[model samples]
Structures are given as structure tokens and as C-alpha cells.
Target: MPGGRLTHGDRRRIAAWLAEGLGYAEIGRRLGRPTSTISREVARNGTTGDYAADHAQRVSGDRARRRRPARPAEPPTAEQPTEVVRGFVDRFATLLAATGLPRMTSRVFVCLLTADAGGLTAADLVRRLRVSPASVSKSIGYLEAMEVVVRRPDPGGRRERYVVDDAAWLRAWQADTGAHARIAAAARRGVEIFGAGTTAGTRLGAMGEFFTWLSEQMSGSSLTASAVYDALTVLAALVHAGRPLTLGALAGALDWPEDRVTAALDAIRRQPAIADPLALRTVGPRTYTLTTRSDRLSQAQREALHR
Candidate 1:
């Protein structure tokens, strides 16, 4: 069973062993599989607290069905492109898929992301992806709806080309603004209907407060791209200083007005990466410092800050 596929019985045993608090190595020893195999299986299936043998088996079966069977190795050819760039594209595509994008959509997005042309037409995408025209069309439609891609008329009077520019993430944020407003409105209505002292009312009130704050931050007239970049500059300065700075000191260091400094800090606090991970911990009444280092950001934190 070391190199063989994991059976349903094997998965059940894994679940049982996990419930018994056995380590991956001990589980592997019992199952005649490698520890890495057991670890990957658990990670891909579910968390340790909620691992289900049946669900894991079904998911594994689906994944196996989706993947193409391995073929014998072949020698490299001069006409064939190097694997280096292709490998990176595949890895990035996988990362995107993990973030909830469908496989085809993730692959198409990554293809555009890696293209030197900066954009591509449907025909170009179909050729590059070796996917049907319908598949490419559907993938493009999904990306466009998510505001992750832009469609522009080609200069040569050809069909429209799909573009993924630097503003794609900005467009996505703008698209989510309406949803946040809707959620806030709905939650506030729930609070009014359920009565202020009720449990449901309290929960709704909290939700309303959070989403309303998010909506304000996202749609605030003063929170422009340039404003965000300035806020990031302030954050970087604090990190470099390696100590807490008062609000007055921050304004002085940036040579900006108190109002400007206040606005930037408000915007930064709404950002999850900066607010949750690299929080501006208060040293005194109006003094703050960066507690998280640059190298300590998690993957999600890095993406939130970068985007």
C-alpha cells in the first residue's frame, strides 16, 4: 500500500487514527504509506478537527478523475519552450484555484498574467490554452463579471481583447462595495425588526457596524489609490523607526496635515493585513507602533497588503 492508491478503508483508518491523536508518522506506519502522503491527504481533505473518511474518499476520487493520467517521458525538442516559465504559470494557477477560482478560469487568468502581450483575444487564448472556443468564452465571461479582467477593442480592428492590468484589483474592490452596502442595510433592518435587546439583534448590530465601516472605508472620497500609497508610506516609516510614534510625530515625519495623517491611519486600520497582523499597537493615548515585521506576514496577509 506504500505506493498504491488510498482506498476507502485506508481513509477510514486515517480518520480513526487521527481521532486517537496519532501523529502522521504513526498513521503512515499503520497504513503502510509515507508520512507525507498522510499529511497531504489530511490537508487536502479537511482539518484534523473535522476529517471525514467518506468525504475525503469522494473528494480524492473526484480529483483523480479530473487529473490526466501520467504518460511516459519524452526527450526535449528545440521547438518546445522551456519548462521554467510553464512551471511557474502552473504553480500560480494552482494558487489562484486555491483562492476559489474555477480551474479553467484560474488557468486562463494566469495565462494572461504571464503573457508578454499584456492582453489576448479569444482566439489567442484558445490557441495558447488548447481549450475549445466555448471554454475560453466562458472563462473570460466569469473573469469579466468578477472585475478581474477588462475587455478592450483591439487596435487592428480585430475582436475584443481581455486585459488584466494593475487596476484589476482596484476594479474588484469597487465591485464589492455594493455588496458591503447591501449587507450593512440588511443587518441594520434585522436589528430593527428583532428588537435591540434580543440576541439576534445584537448579532445583527455587530454585523451592521462592521460592514458599514467597511463600506465607508472602501467608498470614502479621500481614500484614493494615491492616498493608500501614502498610507503605506506612513506604515513603512513607522516600521523603519522601530518604535512607537505619537499622532503628532507621524504628521511631522510625513510633513502632512493632521487631518491627512488621521485619514490615512483610518484607512490603514480598515485593512485586514495591517489591522490584524501588523497592527498599530497603542503605546499611549495617541502613540502607535508596528508590532509585526516585514518577513512575518502570512500568505493571506501579504496578498491583502499587496493588493
Candidate 2:
């Protein structure tokens, strides 16, 4: 339920809605979800190009089986000690993970989003994330470049703390959407490399539409606007470093287990025109670096892909 999968009742309603021939956007509006949410839910679960109320329920349940967190949530009662700080941290972590964010970038964002009072001095984050000051500085530099978070001098302390303003995250998200459209365009160019109608080329072409549509959908303010970029945030992580990374190092740096990192690296490296085909380098033994050349490569690849 972290990503809020549809309920059985919701599935039944979806089937009913489809049976009545309601459009996806209309259905999504009814469900208070994005059209992508509705389309994905049905496409993933609708068996045999046929919408089934009951089967769709099972498919959705299956999708969420492994996705749910193991820890039992505390009761949301008056007596419960639910803290916004903890909620914010958990939610931030969940969103970052969904987006396939780099370990260092995700961790820095988690700190920026969840920092209690101080907003975390460099010394504070250095201590909290247990990384070198250089790592913190690099990650902060990256985040500032993205405009996801801002850095301000602490009034009471000598050190500066990274801070995320209410608006800063939205600014970062706008930057990110632009980035995705750029990458997707690169992926589209692979159609030329692979030839259109070929499997790889087809997927890449679709990717262009996906990125374009996604960016267009998020061009304003709303909870869905905030929530939807969680996916892009994850993808943006891939473009963070100029080169590749090692799965082990990536997992360790992100505080994720080794296996998940390996799996993701494998999946991404399989993409056409990834520039660097090595998963190990993308994950990295060294600190990740995003250079000007990398940005240019991303843009060129995107333009080519979109062509």
C-alpha cells in the first residue's frame, strides 16, 4: 500500500466502469488517480484483453504481494505516536526507491526531506549517513544542480545545512521532467540503430511518448504532480553519474541490499544506447560523477531517440 495499489473493490469498480465503456481518463478521475495509474492497473491485470472484476483483483493483489513493506503499520488512532518526521522519511525513501534513484542521491534527499530541526549541517549528514564529507559535498552539489534542495547558511552554526523548501522540490521535479524527456528522446534514437518495428526500437519509441506524456501531465501543482515525479526521481538517479556503477557499491551506498541493486543495474544496462553497457560501473566502486559530457550525451541520445 506504500504506492497505493488498487483495492479489490476498486478493481471491481474498474471492470464495471470499463464494461460501461467509460474512458481511462474518466475512470481515473472517478478513482482520484492518474490516467497512467488507471491504464497500468487495468493493463497489468485485465486478462486476455478482457476486463474481469475478480481476476483483476487477484492480479493487483499479486502485484502488491512483494511490494508491501514487512513492518506492520502503527494504528492511526489518537493515542498513536505517528510522527510527521518519520512519515516524511519513510515516504521520501519509498518515493526515491520507486524512481530508481542513485544511492548517494537518494540518501541525501532522505536527509534533506526528513531532517528534524537543524536541516542537517554537512557535519550532521556526514555523521548520519556515515559517509565521507566529500561524498556529502558531491551529492549536495548534484542536488543543488537539480534544484531539488537548496543550501543555506545556518544562523546559529558555522556550517551550512542543505534544506528543501516547500517549493524547491517542485522546482527539482520540473527540472527532472525535462531531463526524462531528454533521455527518452535518446532512447527513441535507438530505433534507428535497431530499426523501427524491431522489438528494441519499438520499446524505445514508446519510451519517447511515455516521457513526453509524463512531463506534460506534471506541468502544474497538485498532490498527483508531487506523487507522479517519484517515478522520474528514480530514473534521474541513473543519469546522475557520467559513467557506470557496481551493483554492490550502489546497493551499499543507497542502503539497499546487494541483490536489488544488481537486479536494477542489469535491467537498466539492457536498455539501448545506454552509452555505458556495464552495470558494475553504473553502480560504482568510486563516487558517482555527472560531467558536462554526460549531460550532452544524454541530450544527444534523447534527440536521436525522439527522431
Query: In lDDT terms, which candidate is top?
Result: 1
- Per-residue lDDT of model 2, residues 80-157, tens digit only: 324664466556767886787766777778877766545767877776666798998988887778787777888986
True lDDT of residue 90, candidate 1: 76
**Looking at model 1, which ten-residue stretch has the lowest summed lDDT?**
76-85
TM per candidate comes to 0.45, 0.38
Query: Per-prediction count of colliding residue pairs?
Result: 0, 18
Instruction: Report lDDT (CA) for all predictions.
Output: 0.80, 0.64
lDDT per residue, candidate 1, 1-307, as tens digits?
4669999999999999999999999999988889999999999989988899999989988888789777887764322324875677678889989989998899889878766554788887787667899999999999988988888899886699888988888788887887998999999999999976789987887788678767756766435787777778888879889888988999998899888888778777766343433666668978888776442444567799888
